[model samples]
Target: MAGYKFFMFDPDNGFETYKTAEEAKAAADEAIDYYRGDAGDGWPDEVAQVCWGEIKQETQQVGLRPRDEEDKSSCEMICDYQLTDI
Candidate 1:
């Protein structure tokens, strides 16, 4: 198979890049497990958002909540976190 890079995001841990998708997923899963042990409910929504690119919002919510949540959206959830041509 073709080579690919994996990226993971953590609030306290920042971001990490790995040589393959499996490595990246493992890192992310580990991060979630760590955070879940420490942060409780606040962790998953953020981690899930990172692991999954899409975010859902209702039309009725106003202003900052929607916008703030939008800012955290990531398109690279299940794929390469960053691309380096070299």
Candidate 2:
């Protein structure tokens, strides 16, 4: 079976794998909600926007990225999360 990954901070919890797309989407929504909540005040609006874009892109065309194409950005200042296979 294929797996879905919800992007997160790298070097530690880079991303989370889900057995289904719905699960992955829920994870993505939870992350986005956190970023859009009070805790997000420390971050720029772009961060949330970037995260939303990542989720949107994944929903539009679900797929995993090649390991070589993975972007390991800190995802602090910008959205650099990439959905990948588990």
Deviating ranges (above 4 Å) for candidate 1: 1-4, 39-86
Candidate 2 residues lying further than 4 Å off, grouped into runs, are: 1-13, 39-86
Clashing pairs in 2: none
What would the per-residue lDDT of candidate 1 be over residues 1-86, giving only the tens digit for each residue? 12334566776577666666677778778877876785654545555644511112212322333334445565333222332243
Q: Which ten residues in a row have the lowest lDDT in candidate 2?
A: 50-59
lDDT of each: 0.53, 0.45
Best by TM-score: 1
Per-residue lDDT, model 1, residue 9, is 74
Predicted structure with the largest lDDT when compared to the true one: 1
RMSD of each: 15.4, 13.2
Q: How many residue pairs of model 2 clash at the backbone?
A: 0
Clashes of each: 0, 0
